[model samples]
Every structure is written in C-alpha cells, then in structure tokens.
Target: MRKLLVELGGTRAVAEMHDDIVPKTCDAVWRVLPVEGMAIHANWSSREIMLHLHGEKILRLPPEGPVRRGTTAPGDIVYFWRSPQMSRGKQLAYSSEFQRELSELAIFYGDPAGGGLAADDPARSGRDSNLQVSTLFATLIDIPREFARKCEDVRHTGLQRLLVTRLGQ
Candidate 1:
C-alpha cells in the first residue's frame, strides 16, 4: 500500500505500488526513494514519459521477477531494464544496436487501448523484444484531470523535471 508522489512540471500525480503483484519490483524502487530525473518522451511506447535517471545507478530486476505484458493504461508505471550501449572502437561512431541503454521509469498518460493496442493483444509487440520484457511496477492513483494535460504539454515542450518520492519522505 505504499504511495509515491510524482511531480511533473507544475502538476502533481500519485502512484500506488503494486506490492501484491510485483513485490520485488516495488522493493527495488522503494529502496531508491526520491528518484529525481528528467521526464522525456518515450520513443518506443506511445503516450508515455520515460524518466531518465542521469548518472544514477538502479537496482537490477530480479531473475524471476513478475513480468506484466501488453499495452499499459494511463497512469501505469513501468520499468525498463535498459542494457548498456556499446560504442564502436576507433570508428568514433555510436551504434544503434546499443543505443538507449539507460534504465527508464516510464509513466503512461494515455490509454493504450484507445490507441488500438488491447491489454491482451498479442499483436502489440513493441519496437524490440526488450521493451516487451519491461516490468510493470505500479499504477498512478487519484490523478487530477489536469495531470495528463500537463504531461502532454511537457511532452511537446521538451524534457521536464520529475520527482518520485515516498509519501512521508
């Protein structure tokens, strides 16, 4: 029943951890309280904002952690275990094969179902298999009507500041 307060731009949102369903994942996130990062628009997922924890190390997902599949609804918080990107030696070029290696905290602000991706639709595979393997940790709760609107504004305006912290902390 842990609660997280997420501040995006000037709007405030709340998320309730799914400890019952994803206990391990919730513990991992809880240990890293007050995760401050920049909210960037996701490239692979639609209507989702990815929290980029710059220079911060994150706990690795458990080997047998619970994995949630399919499209996420508005207010769903997903964790992406991004692999480290590799650079081509001596070529001074970055390879797309290993691009976007930082772990991401994704916050969905729109309904995936409305976007033609059903919750149980098997055809909704992500851009890569890695995305499909991301974990669902929590869901936003008691969100204000303006929360999604502000997220949309931030998505279009540029990267915005986001703070994820526990209720008492």
Candidate 2:
C-alpha cells in the first residue's frame, strides 16, 4: 500500500492508496506527486476541497476497478475529471486550461460527504452518471480534527495552498 502526504497550511494527514484494487489509478496519481496548488472549497459537494490540476500536471486517466459510484465517506480521496463539454459556466476558480476541461484531486473531509449541500443534498447525489469519472484511489488513515477544520475554512476564507506528495520521498 503506497502512502501520500497531504498538507494544507499547518494541517497535514496521511493517506494510503488502494493499490490492490485500483493499481492503474494509483500509479497515475503517484506519478503526479508533489502537486501543490490553490485549493478551493466545493459548492456542490459538501465537506470537500479540490486541488485543480493545471499545466503539465493534469491527468486524464480512465475509470478503473469496481469504483463506488455514489456515496462517499469522510477521508475519501478521489481523482475527478470533467470533460470539456461539461462546463457549467466560467470556472473562475480554475485556470484557463481547466475552464473547459478539468482534472482535480478532491478530498472529502467530513460526514455528509458526496452530498451536494452542507445538509443532505439529493440534487447532485455524487452519482456516476453525472461525472465523467470519479475514481477513489486513496483514503486517509486518520482524519485529524484540525485538518478537517482547515478544509472547512476554505469555504469561508478563500483559496489556500494545498500540497500532495509521495510519502517517504
């Protein structure tokens, strides 16, 4: 099981990749290690923050394994890609490259995840039918309270520098 270190400001957490079930996805994510960017909170997905992949760091990987379509738990780290045609207006938070097409690492940090709102949101529902691809490649071993709080802060405080790196590198 390969591990990853995810850092946000002063908070940090470790995640273990589900390589046994999603080898290809795991390898792809591992190759993009040391990715740092301004992360934004999700308006549609609750308790989630996203690190948008820009420039050469963007990955357009295919769906692999028996990925869980809907329903996500806290500590779920997923690789999500949205096709160029799926733009929901100007992606002001993302770069030019991601305006039309997007590749992002989404970190689900709390309960009521995969829902659309802070409460139960059946509108988006985290369904596979809507997303081009959402592959759950890793999950945090333990979600620290501080880390979760920091992620929640992004919703109010604006973009924050988030970094993801391969463990023991």
Candidate 3:
C-alpha cells in the first residue's frame, strides 16, 4: 500500500494505499496531543456523518449522534469510512480490524439502548484495551484513482463525472 501525506487546512495527515480500480474507503489513525488544535467539520448523511478537515471531507463518521453514545473514551481517536458495497445495494462498510475494535467498545460501554448500537459491528470477546488518539484525515468517501491513469494531467477537479469520462482509457 502506498502512503501519501496530505495537507488539510495546514494540518498534515497521511493517506493509506487503496484500490485504484474499484471505489473504496480508507482511514488513517494518527497521534493526537493535548493541544493539537485540530478542527473537524462534519456533514450528516442518511446513514452516517461525513467529516471534513480544511475543505475536504476525508473521514466518514465517529460519534456523530446515537451511533456513539458512550463508545468513545477520553483519549480514543477514530475515523470512519463509508462506501457503496454491493451487499445491500449500497451500504457502509469498514475494515474488519476496525469493526472489531468498535464492537468491543460498544460492549464495554454496557451496550446502550438505541438504534445506535444496532448498526455497529459485533463485539469481540477478549481483553479491553485503551488506544491512543491519533489525529489524521481518513478517506470516508471512495475514489476511482485509476481514472487518473487514463488522463495526461492527473489532477482531480472535484467532479467525479468528468473524471469518470476522461479516465479509464
């Protein structure tokens, strides 16, 4: 997987390698300090929240509403990735490892009563551990990076339709 360092509103974060052919979601966990001064701008979607840093919505969701009533602790940092999968005709999916972690967190919080826990992953049975909060930009939205290969100038213009037509040569 190729790693790319991205700058959001002057803040630096890393982007992990992802599928270039098919649209996919990705998130990066970074270390957060006591006063990192990071700003988060989020937009609510039908099923999840889209997080933005600077002007780009990189992370998908985390503690947006009922989904994380008590799952988050004092210093745990997480980023979400939502994509359109064929399983449910367009559903959100997450990494298996991350899903497991979220499941355990929900159970640790006593499994609060609400629609929030229903959408979360199944809890993992094992030792509960504390994780460090790493501040970084996660790609909650999927991208067709391979499309860039078909073009002479491989710069994104914020328009998927245009990219799709000009890409994949």
Candidate 4:
C-alpha cells in the first residue's frame, strides 16, 4: 500500500488507498483523479474542494464548492486563486520562490505541463520554474513518500545541471 503525507492548514493527513482505512478528524478518503495531474478531488457527497498531496486527501474547512466545466460539472472543486482569503491568518500554500521559479519556466519554456524540462540548449537553459513546480507537485502529490524523496533528488540535480550549464567556465 502506498501512503502520502500532506500538510493542510498546518494539520497533517495521510492519503492511502486500501480497505479498512482509518480517517482522521481532518482527513477524508478520496478517489484521486489521475487525469487532472494531481489536482484537487471533489467531495463525494458535498462537492467540496480537497487537494491530493502526497497521497493524502486534505479538505480544508469552509468547502470551496463544486467545480463546473461550462455546463457540465466535473465533480471537483477548489478555491479559486482569486477568491477572498481563506482564514483570518491562513494564506494560500504557494511560495514566492516557487512562483518565481514557475514564472521563469513559463517565459523561457512555455508552460509547466508534462512535468519535464526541455531546453533548446542543454548548456543554456536550466531548471525552469514550471519544471520545478511540476516536479514539486508531481513528487509531493502523486508519488509515494519514498519515491517522492527520490524525485526531489532528481529535481535538485536537474536544476543544478541547468545552473552549471548556464554559468560554467
């Protein structure tokens, strides 16, 4: 059985797929939508928003409601980036460094899709921001814990290769 750990609003939850699984007060069981690239999973009953991190399905309070795709509902929901603040002190879980890396990746590459980095010049382009985000998300959200750590190592090396190629002697 594969289990992933997730941090939601400072609370911890473990997402696992198996029979007779235990649910924590802040945790819920969910069937991850593999096609969405490890995004949020819609609540089975309430249509609330929940994120799949490290195999753990985390549901923050005050559910974000259903996600509608045009007229058809996709049966998933998440807090819009533009939505009002979530809690009195709670901030979105994004980091400035991460965003900076993502922006660089978007401009230099194209977008952060497919979770891999492709450069016109192996010696010029390095770990773009989008790739970092993709790697982070792919590692932290999709894979199991042990594999996730390996992914992090891969991410580090990939970025270093880019950096060295770009600024080497």
Candidate 5:
C-alpha cells in the first residue's frame, strides 16, 4: 500500500491509499506528490476538511471499476471532482452530469456513530446533487485520536498551510 503524510501546521496524519480498490485515483494522486494547499472546514459537513489544491489543474482519472459511493468513515480521504462548466453561470452547478474539471480532496474526522445516510443524503449532495459521484481513494491508517481532535478543533478556524507528501521521501 502507498502511504501519504499530511501535515497540518505541527500536527501530522498518515493515510494509506487503497490502490487495490481505486487504482486510477491513487495513481493520479501519486503523480501529484508533495502538494500544499489550503485546508478548510467543509460547509456541508463538520466531519470533513476540504483540501483545496493551489491550481486550476483538476485531478481526473478513469473509473477503475465498480466502487462504492458516498460511504465514508473518519480518516477516509475523498476526491470531489468539479465539472468544467461549474463556473459558467449565474450560479455554481455541481452534478455528475457535467464534464470533470478540478478536484477537491476531503478528509473525514468525525465520530463514526454520527455518520450515516444523513451524512450524504441526496439533498445534501453538493449544490444540487453535483457531488453524487465523488470518489473515495484512501483512509488514514496511523492517525491518532489527538490528531483527529486537533483537526476537529480547527474545523472552524481554517488551516492555512496544509502539506501532503509521500512518506520517507
């Protein structure tokens, strides 16, 4: 398994890519190693931290095979791909119907008991179901409860320097 090290300020979190299940997505992320971006609390869910990459480059890869959708747990890393036409209108549109554009990665760090269908109900799927098909590519394998709590504490404060890099070089 491929491991990734995520540093939020002084704290650290480690995640393992599920290459066996999401080979395409894992390969895409591996190609873009050592990425730094802004980590912010997700407006849709308090359990999620949104990692906004610093570029117009949208991460996209062909579906490797049949995969589960919307099911996530604490430490799960997800990739939400934006559509190309998402910015061309009076309002932003999010849907699986449009061509893929940029990608937004989210790390879940909330109570598992508090997550379920409500965490991803259709009505809560992006701004008008645009995120009905986001991909789950990895899961935190060595994250501690303290680190998870730190992430939750900054859920509202916003992290300015979130760094993601492959472990051991």
Candidate 6:
C-alpha cells in the first residue's frame, strides 16, 4: 500500500492510503504529494484538524467508494470538498479561497471520531451531492502521542504547520 508521512508541530505519524478500496481517490491524492500548510482545527467535526488546499493544489474530484452516513474512525484521513458556505455556520478561520471553494485534507486525530457527525457537519450530513463530498483516502497506521497532542493544541493555540509527504520518496 502507498503510505504518507503526516507531520504537525514537529511531531509525525504514518498513514497508509486506501488504494485498494479507493484507487482513483488514492491516485489523485498521491499525485499531489507533499502537501504542506497551516492546519486549522475543525469546528464541527470533533477531534479533527484540516489542511485546506488552495490555488493549483486544490483537487476537484468526485466521490469514490460506498457512502457512509457515520462510522468515521480514528486515524482516518479524508479528502473533502465543499462548494461555498452552504452550511449554517461560517468558516471564519479558513482562507478566502476556501470561502469560495473549500478543499481539505482532514485528519482524525483523537476521540469522538469513531461515530456520529464528529466526522461530518450535522447540517450537511444526509445531503451528499456534487456540492459536498468527502472521500476516505487513507488511514494512519500509527498516531504518535506527540502528534496527537500537537493536533489538539490547534484548538487552543491556533493554526500550526502540517505537512503530508509520500513515504520513501
């Protein structure tokens, strides 16, 4: 399986792509290797942090694999895209580019991820369409304690540098 090294606040974790289950999604993500940016914590999705994509790095792809209402697990990495701000709340922390077209690499770091809308926005849960799509592309093989702590720190301390690079590259 293809793997990636996810780094945040000087700590690191390893994730293996779900290439066998979602080949197209995996391929698309793999092509855009070494994604680096300031990761902001998720407001709706508990225990999650997001790395927003901008400019040419933004990937606009259709959803792949089965649609899951809930059942989001810890260490799951998702390729998420949402058109504009259709939801009730505003994404104030995101960049201006994302305000128009939001593209994100979502990392599930800790508790509250295994079930419910902690992996999704409640307002937009059942409404799956081109307007919004989230594809589970990878799963972290090992979530280091320090890495998890740094991800949690984003909630209090604000945005932190997050990098995702192809393993063995």
| Model 5 regions lying over 4 Å from their true place | 84-102, 112-133
**lDDT by residue (tens digit), candidate 2, 143-167:** 9999999999999988899999999
TM-score of 5: 0.75
Evaluated against the true structure, the overall lDDT of model 4 is: 0.23
Clashing pairs in 1: none
Window of ten residues with lowest summed lDDT in model 4: 160-169
Residue lDDT tens for model 5, 20-134: 9888888888888777766766655557776755454457655454555555777888776655554345322233322335566778877541255535565546576553336
Query: For each candidate, what TM-score against the reference?
Result: 0.75, 0.89, 0.20, 0.19, 0.75, 0.90
Residue pairs in clash, model 5 = 58-102, 94-130, 95-130
Which residues of candidate 3, in runs, are more than 4 Å off? 1-50, 53-71, 86-115, 118-169
Query: Every model's Cα RMSD, please?
Result: 5.5, 3.2, 16.7, 20.2, 5.5, 2.2
lDDT (10s digit) by residue, model 4, range 1-169: 3344443222232333222322221133233322112122121212122222222222222222232222211211122111122112322443222221111111011112222212122322345322211111111223234433322333333221111001110
The clash number for model 6 is: 0
Give each model's whole-structure lDDT: 0.67, 0.85, 0.23, 0.23, 0.67, 0.85
* Candidate closer to the true structure by lDDT (higher is better), 1 or 3: 1
Task: State the lDDT of candidate 6 residue by residue for 53-124, as single tens digits.
Answer: 887888998989989676678899999887765544675777666646778899999988735453445656
Which regions of candidate 6 are displaced past 4 Å? 85-90, 114-128
Best of the candidates, TM-score: 6
